[model samples]
Target: MTDGLEGARERRVRTGEGVELCVAELGDPAHPTVVLLHGYPDSKEVWAPVARRLRDRFHVVLYDVRGCGRSSAPKPLRGGFTLEKLTDDFLTVLDAVSPDAPVHLVGHDWGSVQGWEFVTVRRTEGRIASFTSMSGPSLDHFGHWIKKRLARPTPRRIAQLLGQGAKSWYVYALHTPVLPELAWKGPLGKSWPRILRKLEKVPAGAYPTPSLPTDAAHGAWLYRDNIRSRLRRPRDDCYAHAPVQLITPTEDAFLSEQLYDELELWAPQLTRHTLPAKHWVPRTRPDQLAVWISEFATASEPDAAGVPAQLAAPRTGRYAERFGGQLVLVTGAASGIGRATAFAFAEAGARIVVVDRDAEGAARTAEMARLVGAPDAWPETVDVGDGQAMEKLAARTAAEHGVVDVLVNNAGTGVTGDFMDTSVEDWQRTLDVNLWGVIHGCRTFGRQMAERGQGGHIVNTASAIAFQPTRALPAYATSKAAVLMLSECLRAELAGQGIGVSAICPGVVNTNITATTRFVGTDEEEEKRHQDRTTRLYGLRNYPPEKVADAVLRAVIRNEAVVPVTPEAHGARLLSRLSPRVVRALARVRPRV
Candidate 1:
């Protein structure tokens, strides 16, 4: 009786082995079926959050594997949890749920291990439509991986083998007789919730259901019955028949990413996703999991989904696996860097929220983004400098589209002239659009991301002028410098919450910002001339905004802190750190403008 699966419609199915499995179903039966399986020590409740999110579109089903949750444990409980018995139980459930249609299968940890068996075995062929696996690998695949490494053990292969062996310490522990059961049923079980909270960042109240002790106690046989036999005699013909989606958590302590490097050979139709969380992604990243599952499952079937093959295979662009099906919001997306960033994310299959003060331009960007590859695109009109407007936008975005996974605060107003020459109006406007816009964005959307508890990224567009301060551009430098400092401070603050903040210095890119730049202490005609001249100079520099956009996406993927996009920006950054006095001396030199 966990809080996670409260609303599910429950039933029981007796397997051929005389084991009764408890099943829960949600959503319309007419929709595409998505069946979720739980891992060791976990039951159907582990899929509750993900199930809830998918119910609207998918006929979502979850079931307690035999010997876990409310399901009756095997009479002997020794060899009952073997892969053979598990497959029998799965086929029984599938026949009962959707006898006519194949199901989209999703699994985590031990469940994923079982899924690898189900997808590869010839007996279960044509029963599964697709597989989404996380945190676990096929024992056969793992065995072959080890054998390959050991057959010709190089230094790198030996290191990898040893590293994975170290991570599998629990596997060895689980194979011990009686000790595992005793620990799981006693003090370890009692303290399991707290341990998960402290170590895995798993939220309390919903997981580690009341049957955890018994479940964990009985689940030890999963390793004892299978790990040794399968590894010693791995099957040669274990190729998958259905499309497979592998979701790897980069921070998973229990599993190494190296385990899946050869996954493509086994799964001919393979799509990969990289998550930034730890082991318990079901609890920590349910929303993202649900989105990816829905997208891939739909894309896996052209006829059942009515989506064209070309459109369905959306995760084909650079870094597509990381950004596909994610929600990305880009401010000032009407033109230049912001628009380019939105398009880059779009090409990688992310849903784009195009925002700018220019409503028509934002709409245009969103439209073009959809044509590129974005599953969905939205145009938003907002003045980011207005804190209230930003707050409202955040609330509305949450209400309508869900929380943003990535945020790009790329809006700015350029100001120029000496410190004394740049009037208060110029400073205020520049600060409003540049500094205050980023502040408001970070406050509003960043709060949503933090509250969601799932990881996210924020990219703030600063400039080379931020680090290499110039007398000719005092107000602009001050605002951008403030932005850089704020991004650094915010990154430090959000580091604990898995939210990354990046400040990008793009330098003098060939963008329209130069055309709109205001030259303080100049007549209207003089300002126009200066703007044209600066725009021409930047055109001669010829740095494309698309490259800056690529850097923004790369920074998010790498979780970088400070990124300098242009050559000039990188050199200025180098000078600022290595020799500040030299940079200061250069800052004093008057420009041609």
Candidate 2:
């Protein structure tokens, strides 16, 4: 017999890494666990009410993610606060508390970013079943979004500059050892409440100022080591693949909502949710949060080994499950692997938005997406090769769906020809779809998510050809390689902004691509001859597109930027790394069909 109220209080515990974290335990310990991570300017106390609600059904856990609240914030910072370090912090807590068992994970603001990254990098989705994210974007898309949006006229520029300056105040201070200490001890401490109050859309009469110290220093370390460093170290490869739940507070004062455009490219296995509260939804609507957490912690799913151990896993055993309510937008989604990936995401529980140049094909795919259990699937016909059209599509999709929590830039074209045979138009079209399409998605939706200050995810489709280019198809190879590089660069650049970027690469997939692509030739006989030559020269075997979709889901959860979809592709990649010349020679010795 228990009152279930004892769980709401904060406690201190040691993590696997020997770091002592100030943890708040809510709900009965006997029930399944749910770990809650707090963001900057806050503590575990904010989750008290929410924890209480879940006490009877869930063993809810809340902790300050290494710094802030009662967690140990070592002088000069312990382990530094890069996303990898931050992810380790979460893992430490989980491993120490839950051991090898899985738990439900929930995060808000910076917490959400860390949560997603933790599950991906640690491959802890096996131990941590689901994620409920509030306000975070994929780092890759976020950087592209910020760059494009900030490049606008004077007013927007001024606002961005001011916003970055204001938000970066603590960031600048943390660069030096002396100022962080001074600020923590003096004026910065005194103004903490006022600053936090200004950042929220809370009514004046809602709650008293939290009786917590204004230690912005601990939080600033995250920005410096994780955010800023990632930006400076653009082109680093880091991506995550995991199932996530994203919650957006409609009335958030600090983070805007519009930046979530084309977020589906980032997390195909994402669920979109909303709360009609202020920035402090955990504090304001704690009970609702608790209910959601409880539901997520108790749900179950099958664990399949559909994904590689380095990527994602297929549904197999029963595990805790989270609700699904995400809207995913996929560009170049109508045919080939894009359509199959869209259908796969839908089957995993997502509202799908199928886009392509062919309206009828897109509609048919949308119908399939819906059949796979998407709450609502939409189809839009647009030329991904056109920048203006992509912008319009992004805007329209956001307006229609409210938020694109997941975005997959799976639309691309492969124009295979001898470098000498390929014209400028061939190169432009290939670049337009393969590189520029992804760029457009990041700019349109990523900016909106960034302005909103919530983090999101973006997935750009490249090809194995990007990693190990063949002598032929120079234009196609260059375009895909560029996409891969772009995804890597964005991953580093947008770490602080909370956006994650993953570059998806698949081997040859069986589809109508040979027929649909604009392959220039004289007559029908000549085109057939070209096709036969390509088949004979490459010895290409088409894998199913659904397999690529499975790979995409895995990549998202694991936060891997470079995802090779096939065993052959992986082998080729390894060969390229070990001996480029040997790999090239092997590729040259293709068997004739």
Candidate 3:
């Protein structure tokens, strides 16, 4: 065995056909094994990112399939790359690495296609403990999907078939005689990395290896040898014998989400996760994939009782399909809209980070978030207006919880007074919390999102007063207006980086801000009276903060630039744009003291 990446032990496993397969292993031999299989036109190097992540917790292994990378190709190239031969190669590796123990399996693209064959076959049962598949579907299930659709072709079914057929255009190209090999040996192989970077947003690095031309030329047999025969006579008894986890990239160019609509029929124990990403998740989303793989593999381990391992139950939440397993950070999550937003994302199965100046309140919110359905939740205490404190928080969050997938900057203070009555201190305080707080969040967390190169979203809580002017609320309105403009500018700047920025404008909702609001140019007794009166009026309006929370999720999902929450907010926004004079006239009416 030779030493490779991170002191990985490298060896060779020979198949019965005398083909040498290159295998690399990391971590302790005594630990549970996790075997990672690469896909078409790629080598074991494609799994380097994911393997590095799993090595600490499990025995991670990666191998190049025959005819790719350092693996030796079979003698007769035409009938060399059949699925049965691939299965034999997998079995040989498993027996050589861990003969006494079952191994957890992970596959991407064509590797996933091969894994479907492994876990479903009776001869391979009990040797495989669990399977995690991505970016590929089972040929048998696909065959059944097509047969059912053709047997009774509804309009929706026809559309799905046509859509998938269009996506499979490359399959036809690969099936051509000698053309694919020529293309791979010529210009196509040299430009493959550049094409992946431009089209799929795969990060540029030392991947696809120097032998890509030979690898791809030989990989064409993967499609030509299996697809036609399997689809025509797919096995009827193809059911998985182990717990299965399926991670689907929602934006994969080669596969449609509809392809797995009836997957439950084949796999009785199934857990599904969706990622808002394109193809090549191993390169772009290795962190998230590693986390999920570790969780599934750990759950599949048998207990001391020697009973069969029980898989985790699937997450059944409203937005689980969109945000499950993602990290979300909500600032000012101690009360009002911020706390409600945290709870909403938690209910969607996202991990939550609650940040607020009130340490106890933040901790309480984090605890409640776990009960609601968050996989995990943590609390961080810091005043959003404190730039240094926010910078520390951002660094700690990235280091501990990974890069935040969604950020909600909902911290603000209420100020009500005439321009002259509002002192300079009051103006500075409001701007510090309302305007500068949002700036701190976007600058700190948004920079991390940009650096990570994966897409994310930022939500800033502006107010209806941003566009609708009022004489009694000058300082508060100005601060909120700046937030709205900042969100717009950031949205335009970050569009190219795949980051989304949204300004949530709410009119009036019953919350605690009114009671804490400052009244300028008033005695202590008079200020107390004004606070009670304003709180009463807002309570009578009776708008719930939960509604605003719902709008925040919608804005992130749709990547909306500006969203008006309340009905009055919508009307006010329209009036401000369509009839400015009418809006100004309405704003002239002052609130009663």
Candidate 4:
């Protein structure tokens, strides 16, 4: 009880099964109750980080299951750790905490497994208002999944079965007779904290290891009692009785994402989330998890905070599940691709920070982002070309709105000219915004994301000219080429830190960038004419900025290093990779403009 939850009032509730469950309570009891549950090899201490964040708004509760932490293990632990018994323990805790009001249930790992049991079984129905699950699936659903796969056994299904089987080697290890107990009580126990830090990215000294060995040793019965039986004869009536939120860790080693392919069949009221983290999100990404859990729990209480009708509905955007509640910053969001990208993320329910050199335009974009479904949006006026301003913007963003989960380095100016015709001023201006802007963004905000220790994404907008060089636009091509290299280098550098860097090549989508484009060595009238002609040609192509925006989101979700958005952009990329001589020949041709 005293492990990590400071100021938490702890008590022991004795179950009918004669097991004493250790329960911790925080916040005002009259507020909406939110129960936090941990998993195998972990006690209620695992929920400490997330619980701290939720205590202000909700009555937070944490409890060690019968056999773990400070709780008394059941007598004859073999059969005592069954899901049926676990359900009884949960009910006992629920009755002791809040008898009249239903509580919001949250779980991780084995806790999620137990939560699935709690939310699905009829005995506990009407007691749980909502259930948020991560890193665990229902035994019934898993059983169904296995049955379906074995029934068909296609090549793909066979491979999936084998893959999941390998990932679950630890489960098989625990099922071995006395080996698990020996390992947990011995060297494995002492080394677990180190293993978690090295593999799961859980920071050192943050994870509580004092009671881990004992807790883990006792917790093995959880797998022993429930896994084989339930997985073999999973209940047919195991359908969720409450709204469910499922957060899937993309890089989880123990579970496969495909396991939840048919989860909607079991959880009718479901919201899905995909995190780029590994297994232990509770420790590594508590901030993001807390936000999501609060949002999901709050959504259940429609009249509690005067919730709007639109906010109450399920998100319908493409990556809504992944991006919802995340903080995103987009530079050059006043117009063109940046504006479209801001709107796209807004529709996915991300909190937007719309930034641009133009104050009024940035404000307008922020307002539009909120209108489109962003939980909140703010405008900042800053020239990306100025390194000092970008640094201030980065610091202010972190201080005011939290570290941006996604940063779009999208501000750039277009320059068109032959190498000889381009002046020193033109080259400097082109490099300042196109190359140095991206440099400042990555150096400043990327550091913040790294310092936060949670993962984030950085999107740098390049141009097709980066790939397919042209004689007509030497200065623009050089700046974009530099951007492409920077993105590649940063991607490699940040791969270790869970930060992704993507270079997006948008080709020539119809945007007002033409208005700001500079034509070197051209007379004023001729420059205007070229700009008009280029804008008209781009309009005729009718490739929308929205498509490029979609590509940006997709690239981040997939962690793609380089993305070419339009058809021409894709073509240029392919040519650059497959036929450099052809690209060079094409580059030799002069543009009519």
Q: In model 1, where do residues sit more than 4 Å from their true spots?
A: 302-316, 392-405, 417-426, 445-456, 470-472, 492-500, 519-537, 557-561, 567-593
**What residue pairs are clashing in model 4?**
none
lDDT of 4 by residue, 1-593 (tens): 46678889999999997789899998999998999999989988888888888899999999998778889999888898988898998899989999977889999999999999999998897788899999998988999899999998999999988999999999988989988888988999888888887777676754665878788888999999999998899899999988899999899999999989979999988888888778999887776788889888988753545331223667888888889878899999999999999999999989899989999999999999999988779999999899999999988887565678999999989888889999999999989989998999999999988876677999999988899989988999999999999999999999988899999998878999997799988899999999999999989988999999999999998999999888888999999999999999999998887
- Give the alpha-carbon lDDT of every model: 0.89, 0.66, 0.90, 0.89
Q: State residue 510's C-alpha deviation in candidate 4, in Å.
A: 3.8
**In terms of TM-score, how similar is model 2 to the real structure?**
0.50
Better of 2 and 3 by TM-score: 3
Question: What does the lDDT read for residue 324 in candidate 2?
Answer: 44
Instruction: List residue ranges in candidate 2 displaced over 4 A.
Output: 1-323, 518-523, 529-542, 586-593
Query: Tens digit of lDDT per residue, candidate 3, span 74-149?
Result: 9889989998999999999999998878899999999999999999998898889899999988999999999999
Which of the two, 3 or 4, has more lDDT? 3
Ranking by TM-score: 3, 1, 4, 2
How does each model score on TM-score? 0.89, 0.50, 0.89, 0.82
